[model samples]
Target: MSTPRDLMIVALDVAPSRPLGRGDLSLALAGAEAYDLLRTGTVRLRGDRLAPLTGPGPDRLAPLPPPGPEDGLLAEAAAALVREEPYEPLPDWLWRRGRGLSSAYLAALEAEGQVTWERSRWLPFRGGRTVLSDTEARRRAAYRWAADEPVLLALAAAVGIREELTPADPAVTDDTALTVLAAVHDAVMELEAVRQRRALEAAAFANVWRGA
Candidate 1:
């Protein structure tokens, strides 16, 4: 049987088999806590499994809000696990349209020596000549968003519970825990879909904008 964490990692496209960073570890723990809580029944997982848990549907015209501070921290952690940097400080327009953390943050982290950005460059890896395809860039962004979603969800739920996020909820049970996990699964899927759609749109727009 696949554990909740395993399902989440796959859904978020995170390679859980690799080592993790502090923030990534924290997020993973938080996800585990949420799973436990749901399993124990401390918090009830309500609403339709397929319904939007916290954001608008994928087909909507309005964009979702960019990730907040918690998201940034979690994303940083996840990227570190992959030996990459977390993207950040996205453009205002994209943020308003619900773009998550900016890829710039990861670049900034790499420059700061907080984490390594893995990829083959034109020059030596250390010579700063790494080459990255648009698809690779999009995948990185998706992973960051996926890893951060659980953390954000737990934090938001914690606000109502008046407690810190944890792996075990005093009030959740196995059945309900699965429901909550499903909610998380839904959120990750939505985020990934949005990221891919935006990337495609951006690529097309770039081509048109450049008269290519």
Candidate 2:
């Protein structure tokens, strides 16, 4: 099934070398993956922890037969967390998940020849970098992106991308895409607020404790 994660992958047609913008693509992918699994009935979510639904397979947790690769990737990620932590909120799981996942996903796409990256050695840093081979070309073609759907637009806005969206946008109108986008946006914003509050509270506590 072509899910939001798939859209995210396409939207991020940036070469591995370029900045993937300000938002966290990994978190975006994880949320999309969890929502897709929830919709597909291959998995069930309990308080942020994703658990496989009982089925014919000997291992309920095995990556659901890839309706698409993103499914497998997301399943693998979720499964790993379930194994490590008994229960972790999806957002928390996303923050604590390992690095390089976004790169891995892009590499898989590169292997499929759907996209390509070029390795480059720039000055001031001996370590070379990889960049999307034709970022401008793909960007020009992406003009039609998310025209029919606004979930991705919502994601962009949530991450401070500031897309030009109308009141008719799914995020504003409360459409199906909103189900995914709003959930992601709300979760991310709520988490950020919680984190800020905690930081402030800690600072206050430290000031008092240190003074005493």
Candidate 3:
């Protein structure tokens, strides 16, 4: 029902040709969370920085309202908001909130019965694969994916799925949503760069050892 959950279901249901990296998916899920919170007026972007919406107060900056009870992970995310001046930048928020987010969502889905593990018919003793259950949540996510909803499509593209709507498509018109998508893209690329740098370092170390 939530954007992050819907994106996770879409990823599993679509099963893209190239496997998605968990890190990349986690970053996009964080972006999806930001998008949903923005849609609900829980947060807002001030020129690429994220700030939680506060209620009226004498100081003009009250505490953030609580997240809905149904989404515990989102509650945690809301609590993690940087509620001071010089609020956290969008890309930094994505990297911070996205840590291990994919695993958290997967565990939540499994516990909620939204996903189930099914063993292969031919290999009874082997490990089973988790699949989405036939539920309204899955159906709604599928419909959104089929419709190429801009937010979902942009998140999917950040995770390297090229089959759906491109991020450049004019479907997403909201300036705030577009900002979230751009931050997600930048974060993913930064993560990829880190991975490449680490790989190169490892290769150089191995070469030095071999020469010695």
Candidate 4:
């Protein structure tokens, strides 16, 4: 029952039974979309050396070049992602990744029954809101990965959510599975440090203008 969005949702709701505030939803969605794009070859990440995986023929290490100008959120974020210094952490560089992607994966996650939204008691329309959700599936996956459960272990390894990263419990293990968890954590931290960071918000509003 777990979907790609759950990867981000688990990071947002570590506890199995609490509601998550909507303020961070934009950042969470960005992380989810980043993971999907990365997993599907829409983007690529190089270890340590950190050069973007995009270039000419043999030079084109990325599965696909970043999306174009009219392609929307993933494109915008990919454009920003390659600009960071090679020495910077991938998570840190992704603060601006996928600029207007906060809502794309959410509907899918909700449709899958992993989360539920309840209208705000006060400002039902634009005010702050939170959604109820759980992390059972992700937690279980993490636990299996830690225990070196064969199938999950291979999957995690193939994806770089290395076994050495997990502990004995069904825990986050530095939030590695989908890569989005760590990125979301960093993005939120970055957003907090610099409150003026409104690119995501601006892009979000712009979508409304385009009738998206």
Candidate 5:
């Protein structure tokens, strides 16, 4: 299973009570995709920018390498890569690709029978709870998460699952992975800043409305 998918499963399984912010999860997912692509040699970092190994196309958008990622969502991410020179910066790519990415992964997991919905009988109109299925994918993700696998831990930390980002894990010695993790951390912080600004704006507006 792909790292993003595994990360999603691990997030759902471990923190059902905490429930990740979708925006944070999406950023982490994008980072997970970046890390996996780098690991697989389907993409490389040209000094913190992504350079997907894709073929040329008419509109400058390109196709992914043959048999890109086994997961369709990940393959789609590869296709979304900026094919031209001045390739996208890692943080930019995360924000762009991460928009609604959590929903996409959730839908994909539902379709693959990796997740199921349990609705209250009396409140059928309301949204139901999503439960992970007892699948091999879940087991594999659980094992990796249990092992404190560096990539997964880093991704989880970005989403506030882990308390803090620590020194680099010896297991994640690759420069590419380290770069991707750093970008993820910065992107998540940027997102949190945006959220804070929006919240403050809303509160100010509310006070103005009350005064008026």
Candidate 6:
């Protein structure tokens, strides 16, 4: 049988924005469930913290101001977040444009009911042509984190299940293994709920903007 890692390797090779096909969705959901088990398992894997997945330190995970000229690096960073290789260093104007595009994409996702938006304010700081406050960066991170929940859950579940099942035959089962699988399933479901909500919100928002 193919292991979770093998499945995930295939998934990651695909583009992030690729719409989830039925098979893809099934695998992703299963993977998310398996991940929860791994985290709570006895093996105690290292580097499971939310900080590394999200960004810098926990404290830095706050809302940040809009990007400025100096913050052009953010565009590259954002592209990286989506796992897209940066093409060229974005110019100040292009960086701003990219930021706007990223925000719009998030907002669209929210309107479509794939995610939710929580409002917060931040103090502004200078960058290039625009000013970015620390608060805005934090806010962006929060949104990004939320958006990434589904993928993360999938990854975790896949790893967890793989670790548990690799040593035994496909038919083997113990109470501990069963419990871990259940937890993984539960986590994936929660993430799916969030994604659905964001998608709905994004659709609604787009409708309003389009005046339809």
Top model number, lDDT: 5
Q: Could you tell me the lDDT of residue 1 within candidate 1?
A: 16
> Candidate 2, which ten residues in sequence have the lowest lDDT sum?
55-64
Candidate 4, superposed: residue stretches over 4 Å from native = 1-3, 7-23, 47-61, 65-93, 97-100, 107-182, 195-212
Question: What ranges in model 1 sit over 4 Å off?
Answer: 1-31, 39-41, 46-173
Q: What is the C-alpha RMSD of each candidate to the true structure, in Å?
A: 15.6, 8.3, 5.8, 12.3, 5.7, 20.0
The sequence of per-residue lDDT tens digits that candidate 6 reaches over residues 1-212 is 11232233333333344343333334333332233222323121222244576753211111123331221222333323211222221122122222333243334334444344333345234332212223433344334334543334334333342222232324314443343344434544554677799999999999999996
lDDT of 3: 0.80
Which runs in model 5 stand beyond 4 Å of their true positions?
16-19, 48-67, 165-171
Per-model lDDT: 0.36, 0.51, 0.80, 0.46, 0.80, 0.34
Give per-residue CA lDDT, model 1, range 78-136, as digits (tens): 22221112222111112232222223334444454433545455644454422333344
Model 6 per-residue lDDT at 185 = 48
Query: What is the C-alpha lDDT profile of model 5 across 100-204, one tens digit per residue?
Result: 999999999999999999998999989889899999999999999888888898788778776665665535677778778888888888988999999999999
Model 2 per-residue lDDT tens digits across residues 1-212? 43443544555652333334323565565555655555665444443223446432211222233343355565576456453334445455445552444566667656655465444545434554344444443443354344544555555555444444567665445433344455566556665688789999999999999999
User: Model 1, poorest ten-residue lDDT window?
Assistant: 82-91
Deviating ranges (above 4 Å) for candidate 3:
48-70, 119-127, 164-170
Query: Candidate 4 lDDT (Cα, whole model)?
Result: 0.46
Superposed by TM-score, candidate 3 places the C-alpha of residue 170 at a distance from the truth, in angstroms, of 5.4
Local lDDT at 15 for model 4: 43
lDDT of 4 at 132: 39
Better candidate number, 1 or 3, judged by lDDT: 3
Candidate 5 residue 192 Cα shift, in angstroms, is 0.8
- Report the candidate with higher lDDT, 3 versus 4: 3
Q: What's the TM-score of every candidate structure? A: 0.30, 0.53, 0.83, 0.38, 0.86, 0.27
The residue-by-residue lDDT of candidate 3 on 106-141, one tens digit each, is 999999999988998998889988889999989999
